[model samples]
Target: MRSAPDDDRPGRVIPFGKGRDRAYDAYGHAYDADEARGDHGAERRVDHLTRFMDFLRRRVAGDYEVDEFGFDPELTDKVTLELMRPLYRTWFRVETLGAGDVPAESGALIVANHSGTLPLDALMLQVAMHDEVGRPLRLLGADLVYQLPVLNHLARKTGHTLACREDADRLLRKGEAVGVFPEGFKGVGKPFSERYRLQRFGRGGFVASAIRAGVPIVPCAIVGAEEIYPKIGDLPVLARILGLPYLPITPLFPWFGPLGLIPLPSKWMIEFGEPIRTDDYDPGAADDPMLVFNLTDHVREIMQQMLNELRLRRGHAFPPLF
Candidate 1:
């Protein structure tokens, strides 16, 4: 069993089977500091390898269905995880906290303040959940995401679904991790003046979803995302013409042309606060404005605290240059 690190440290990649194009994560899991041999340990590796060969043989013999879960028993959960190593490394230099609080097999609603203005924070969070926390988190993406060509395909492959309550309920019922940004596009597109200040969590859909599903809510706070592409202004007419939600005018890119899209190397801090249990709440509590308001206020407070703490932790904010 290859152990992942408890803290967010740098990671490297190692190749898997020949011509596989897959990679193994040298970095350990979020809570696991015990470094074990990769491939989930030697015996497990052999088992998976054998199973994979058997799977291939069966495929060649036309005796299998690829869609079935665990169809390739040889490719254990460990192997599947290894394939994601490279993706995490390229996107984030994450600093994690409260990872040990995550339950091994319980459903969770990960509520985060959406920043990065581009939804990259969501993808980074998903990668962190899967590779660092050792589990896949189903993301609730916006409807606009599915409208794009490649983005839509990648989102599905990465286990994202349309932001719908039914989908959330179904996943939680199955003990799966689900992530949602209550701010939605409004939060992401907020001006630079509003950086780190969370928008209102509308009608408490997340609260309702959690209460209905009887799951705990995990408040996630992310710093350094706001600097990714600081929106100095919005060209609403151009945005409408382009069919975009907002026409962002960052310091670079549109202002300075295409070069603006490159995100500055701002160190990232992502902390998961202790879970707020809704399991004990009355199912009808969703309609109570007091309940929704309190919950939203509570989560917002935690996120703000994290932002303040991370600002101190980082010593100084990196000059916000998009």
Candidate 2:
């Protein structure tokens, strides 16, 4: 009988075969061939853990700054935004157009249509600005966002505050990019049948805010978010009880439990239109009702037109074109 081959040898033959032996001995330290192959995955996990520890150390050592609103740039960039990047890149496969239209240095307002039962669109836009435009977007969110416990904390750390004129003006005056979804709950909770139909922007408040701050309004149109979780219906009573706008009824949700909440992978395209300057208008233009309405309508029209064009380019929301 042939002597048993040494299991620790790199090229040692085993009963399984030469290929199996090589794989089993790939990590040299392990005495058992079976254990060596299993260590590969553990090794990768160790590497990830090590990097994460380093990141935390930097944050804890005052290498990062947190703004008054609790916006921690380092944590948001390294941890929170990093977690969302895979979804933005691989799942949604977001394609950006007219990124240059966004002002690199000056303060500006980003006005966009909002949809998707969850405010995933907002998070994705945040990723886009950070990764593509190379700027941190300060988003103005609704009261509901700040009312939730854990969510409120994360939202602030990610640079979102209550959607009030005061907050918007403050951010803009500081030369920070501000984003607002004028449609509010009306656009987000609409039925699937009404998808992509722009809702009435609330009182042109965003327009007034932009005018007062003397910043340009950049119309942003996003396609593919409408289909994420098709809102077939809603339960108003439950929503009221839960203090939510509406209890969304998607195909899988409320029926399949938590597993159904997974969003369908949709191809996303975000385009920024040419900036509409507010500098020419008088300072009082913000207070003028008619002026605010006209400018609001103008931004809405531009977004709608862009939506139509993007929809035409992307044929189907699912099976999105690369």
Candidate 3:
């Protein structure tokens, strides 16, 4: 019979629509999102504050832990990365490409050109990797980085270690993302005229480390760092006195005092290329100097090509602020 028309029938269909559900909207959400726009913002603020408070509590109670490399993941994630996000997002407006090429959970070595006056590029790269792919890029630093008191402390806490084969191998074997700037100070301290020109990758140490760890090597290209502080000149005497690689003399820096230290708001682009697999190599291939050297050169060439392409895409350094 058509007695109750199927309204009370078993498993009755509700026909999708806002007013169709007796409880809440089935198409949109359990609650009307449009009706509470301001509420979301307020909730976010509350959540942020709560997290900050929790961080402070951990610091006070000494409840934080560090890895074997003295990497304080808590501080790096809660404080360091959060602080760098604004610079990566607004100031430099860094745009990342091919980030998905990075291995999701496996070990990999990232080889990239280094630039920018003070290694800001490294920090930006680290932030980008962590934010985009949810992985930490452990940077290998030179000896000088660990000699200075303040910089040494910060470096260790932020997961940086001596740029040695031992450390790199250890990190890679642990399934962690390792990053190396093979050019050292050469690429970062080069003159403005030589911008985007890669320097000789020292001895291919990074390649050997990757091979030993049986990890893929991902070549990365970073553009726009060259113009940030524009290494117009260098003060060798001052650099020697300060124990710095080079005392960069940008147009504004050391002239305008602290104001000169401000980096120009240049557009930045980072590209991660496909990983070159090392696991396929035969036994003991890591000890072969020629293979390591060849791989190193290949990575460098790919990075340079990527830089050239990215430069064309970025056009000029600065864009309209608005």
Residues 1-322 of candidate 1: C-alpha lDDT, one tens digit per residue: 4332222222222112221123333222121223334555776455545645544554466553221111221232234444544434644466667776666578999988887667768866765675456566778888888899977756665566778878878778888788899989889999888988888776677878888888899988888788788888889999999999898888885866777877766667778888989989887887787887888788778877877777567644453432
Candidate 3 CA-lDDT value: 0.81
Model 1 TM-score relative to the real fold: 0.74
Residue 57, model 3: lDDT of 59
Give the alpha-carbon lDDT of every model: 0.68, 0.82, 0.81
Best by TM-score: 3
Model 2 C-alpha lDDT per residue in residues 109-207, reported as the tens digit of each score: 999999998889999998888767767889999999998899998999988899998999999999989999999999988899998889999999989
**Which residue runs does candidate 3 get wrong by more than 4 Å?**
1-51, 320-322
TM-score of each: 0.74, 0.83, 0.85
Model 1 clashing-pair count:
9
> Sort by lDDT, best first: what order?
2, 3, 1
Ranking by TM-score: 3, 2, 1
Report residue 143 deviation for candidate 1 (angstroms).
Answer: 0.9
Clashing pairs in 2: none
